[model samples]
Target: MAGSTKTKAKKPTVKKPSANKAAEASHNGAAHAFAPEPGDFRRYFDSGHTHESLGITPETLLDMYRNMLLQRRFEERAAQMYGRQKIAGFLHLYIGQEAVSVGSVWGTRPDDPIITAYRDHGLALARGMSPNAGMAELYGKIDGCSRGKGGSMHFFDVDKSFYGGHGIVGGQIPVGVGMAFAMKYKETGGCCLTYFGDGAINQGAFHEAANLASLYKLPVLLIVENNEYAMGTAVHRASAEPDLYKQAYAYDMKGAIVDGMDLFEVYHAMQELADEAREGKPALVEVRTYRYRGHSMSDPQKYRTKEELEAKKDEDPILRVKKYLLDNELATIEKLDDLDESVKAEVMAAVEFAENSPVPEIETMYEDIYTQSDYPFLV
Candidate 1:
């Protein structure tokens, strides 16, 4: 048979699908595979809980309000700047999620390190980065933090222990763990507040970091700023376990969900979790928050409905704090109005400062690249 020039059967060639088609298939699979729970995620702190029981003074409350308001106004101005083409590149506004950053920051000690994903202006402001420097950074000015190299997504203040605003999704998870490991190694009594969006919870980096943190009992608080979406994709669509805090169960780490819209609740939850983290017990805290703005300046935002956004507006964290101040008779309307006006003026001044600041020099681009400078090429 072999010598008779027999026709061999040909094996079928399997053509791999296009990248777009493969992505579409993957998206469809994810969309269908996700199954969210019917009820809310289990939480440590309830909304509408009074901080008076915890002896949080009215002055502290006012400070919290001011911090949140400052962030809100700063972002509002940043958005305006983006509209005017003054602020270039990506601008991810942290409009409605102010309480999450402000409250969590206020709960932590001054020396505790903070690292978050982009959409980080609020966290930087909350961590005491100067509004002028932050705005200038957005403007790419020489006076800006990171010498204007970082822009909107990479705000860093080494003195304040504010690590960075990482642009890559979930990239800061392991970095934060490393920071926490350093804290534990040095016995600094300072924990790392590692923040990422609910979208990042699906990332393998998050799981690996969480596992390592739990395994080593590193002093790290993994905070998921569950703003419901990762860019355009909603939690229900992207995550198999949309209840993000429950993912901590896999590592047997303590976990809690908090009302991120309520500043008091966020502060309390962060305080508890951060304390535990500092005591060498890693924890996961999912702050259920929302963003009023689109993912970035360029986003068209077709993923979610207008009605859904409107519904979330009623729970605006800034508004909630304002209501709390008024309802408790802690501050008169005039005082609150004055505070708002002051914040607006401060934000405007920051914008002016950024406008006046000089741009970075081309020669300095190679500076701050590395700590050790004895390169063979330089020699």
Candidate 2:
């Protein structure tokens, strides 16, 4: 009995995924996408390139850099606010993945429907949501975008066509498809940008949504913000197809992967996908990004090493744009420093606004509830 033998089953090998117009076959099993593995993402977006080359004006580039700074400073302040217990419930920071949202948004129109996962504050800010309203929402005050009802994970702005800050993993995937369907039906040339983390790729919802979007030729861009980790689990360990965008092949949808650390790469990739999506071609894009903080406030983050984080910091999206601006001579050091100071002041004011804003009134709860015929107290 001790000498009895059993054979192990062979595992299928999947070559890593690549980016751009169409998927390409690899020679010698190499990936077309150069990102987290390369350690030198800046080489592709070399110091020689200018904002004009990227089709953005000098002032617009400055604005993009400023927005990135706003996101970083906002998230930093939000962390402090959470620590003080001024903000309650869960708080997920978007410190390191600003480019994925900002760059993707830059490639699309303001009217395009934007929906994303619970890590939403940065996207909201990038899309022009005021810091005061955003911080107020975190503080659960009446001035919040959701009237303080949605909290951190449910920042919604109908005016901006930003549908939600969805809480459930993979829940927003189907909803995004539906939004795209509506866009197509209305004959609106807008492409719906559906954002989710790497964690949501395997969900049945994503697969089902992708099938429908591809089958009907919906105008939807399924953007997977592959931040290396889905909560605590690394992408490779959790996913059978670790190169997440390749999952699009199942539905015959086009897919591309980008160096999420580089804003130019993200923007250019997203711009191409958006053009296709608006023409009724469903697509998937994996913005390979990273989050510096733990998955959420409660996470201890014992999974990763401090050295790994320090190395990632070298590719910081905010610094990338700042470098481009300075190196291109579009902005001076004093100008950039002043921009930082102004952004700092703006964040501080948002904190003050949240502190002073009043909590939501009880009657409003009865008002938003769909089942209500009349307010219970009023009745």
Candidate 3:
């Protein structure tokens, strides 16, 4: 007893209650349940109205028509080239979704940065990127905007501020945010128009970018070009909350849904949203548009029926704009026909230019690979 100290009795350890169970218990007896109100999502403008009321002149309408027609014709030719094996790699045609890009681009300033997913020829053309350059990029020619390196999905025009045709789903989200952040940091009086699809809205990148954009009040317009499908998967099947614009509510930002099939509606909505974005208010816009073709040239398109595709054709943006032009007496049928002929000719010339252009040299593969010069080891 004198040599050895008596051991103290060990106390039994007690496990603490689970925090999740405690939280549930605290709410168990509450009379009210937590329920969030539905977001106030509505079309901000009427699609049926004439552009005159919105201060869009006849000339501007004609330009919009021409740009949309140019994009359509260019894509048609590109599809033909793909079929002929003249153009290689993935060809994501922007057949029916032309209005979203054309109208949205027209709504923003010329210097404002614009970015979109791989279905991007329309956006590049709408932003005034030359068809020759775009087609050359598809042909992997030296005259391409990316020096014949980017192919169909990576069209980038630094001079026009067209950021890129990002190939990865939701890959452009944070890049767009970074561009907006730069604009804010530089006080450039410019904003960014970032476009993705309904499929991308489910990506974590979009949510993180949306949260950051809201937190920093970044000048960016996050557009969800909801064509109802992400590749073969339908939006309804993929998203638990199919209403994409409402997702912005979680970030405490403004959101709206528009008839992306109507050029006038898209133009007006984009105009207002672009103005808001330039004023440092980031917003989410869901453009309910549809694509006429398969996800890519290789797709068999077993997901939807021919009947569904035919039904959506009735709301074709190009045809709708053409009808509006005729109905409003903005342009006669003859003039429109002439304009269509001109666009076709232009597209054909672009194809010829691409055919004649030289392919990028093998050495070019090493160029434009890295931006940092300090990494001399790369050489």
Candidate 4:
């Protein structure tokens, strides 16, 4: 035994993919063999964007369009309030990624668990959080969803089934997995939509949660809002492979790349995969959207060119929906204008309400942070 003396056996090291397999995978587009394109994907699902897709009612289309508009308007109003110093704190606007939230939320069932990053005002609005309540929260007013405890990045509405406006980049991934685990354990037949940005995808939490979620075949939809730039750092600069969708292959799960600017595409893709997830399979969807606003309100345009930003803005999600509605004769310009006016008025009311709303009393601060009986004793 002494002579055998602690020689650690060399573990077999698997080689990287050979040139042949890499070429084949390249020819095949991805390891999964089903990377959706704009055209093929457009015709594949019946999400009511066109007459060909199934289960698309007129009401659903209208609802989707309306929700997209509402989110866009809400953010625009928030930006104005932020500029006026009415809303304080770091405000991350989801100006262009409206489709990701609107489509994804609409794709899932009402009672399903929804968790997202700090750019969650859109998700909250899409999930039926009142604009007034959401804006009020951004203003740190008591009438806000978190009762004024959470500012822009911490809106939590329990009744609406939205988990939180989580501040940490990849922190919510496990929370979503846990939610899915609950659904699986209870056989609830529901799914949890865990959304984070492209930047967070590189975090260890993302990989670990993805591994566990796939290993257990939990009903979880891990969606990446790959908006090109991770807070001013482009995906190419930050990652070896900017294709965030393919990152799911590490977990042996299917992933899809989608045009995040296209609401119908976002909605249909999410709907398809969410239905699959409910059947006890996990999935990853990377939405290739862009943000028109800076990483936060305080950011200056030092990273990219204005031309680039303007180009991306031309493909805006709200504008796309508006065009689709007009092209299909779903709504007239007057109708759209009226809707805009109504939304603007609603946003105005939110501002007025937030201004009048009281801030949390000093004593109330000690209450929400912890629910334990010994909290007072410790304090």
Best candidate, TM-score-wise? 3
Off by over 4 Å in 4: 1-54, 373-379
Task: Name the better of 1 and 2 by TM-score.
Answer: 1
Model 1, which residues run further than 4 Å from truth? 1-42, 45-48, 371-379
Q: Pick the winner on lDDT between candidates 3 and 4.
A: 3
lDDT of 2 by residue, 235-308 (tens): 98999879787787667678777888888777777787789889988788888889999999998888899999
For candidate 3, the clash count comes to 0
The order by descending lDDT is 3, 1, 2, 4
lDDT of 1 by residue, 1-379 (tens): 6579767999999997555755766774532213434331347556557768656899988988999999999998899998999989989999999999888888779888999998899999998999999999999999999899999999999999999999989999999999999889999999999999888888899999999998899999999999988888889998888888888777767778888998888888888788888887888888899999999988899998999999999999999889989999999999999999999999999999999999989987988787656876774
Model 4 over residues 197-275: C-alpha lDDT tens digits? 9999999999999999988999999989988888879899998989787777777776777878887787788888888
TM-score on alpha carbons, each prediction: 0.87, 0.86, 0.88, 0.86
True-structure Cα RMSD, model 1: 10.7
Give Cα distance to truth, residue 23, candidate 3, Å: 16
Cα deviation of 68 in candidate 3 (Å)?
A: 0.6
Residue 6, candidate 4: how far off, in angstroms? 46
Which residue runs of candidate 2 sit more than 4 Å off their true CA positions? 1-49, 372-379
TM-score, predicted candidate 2 vs. hidden true structure: 0.86
Estimate candidate 1's alpha-carbon lDDT, on a 0 to 1 scale.
0.88
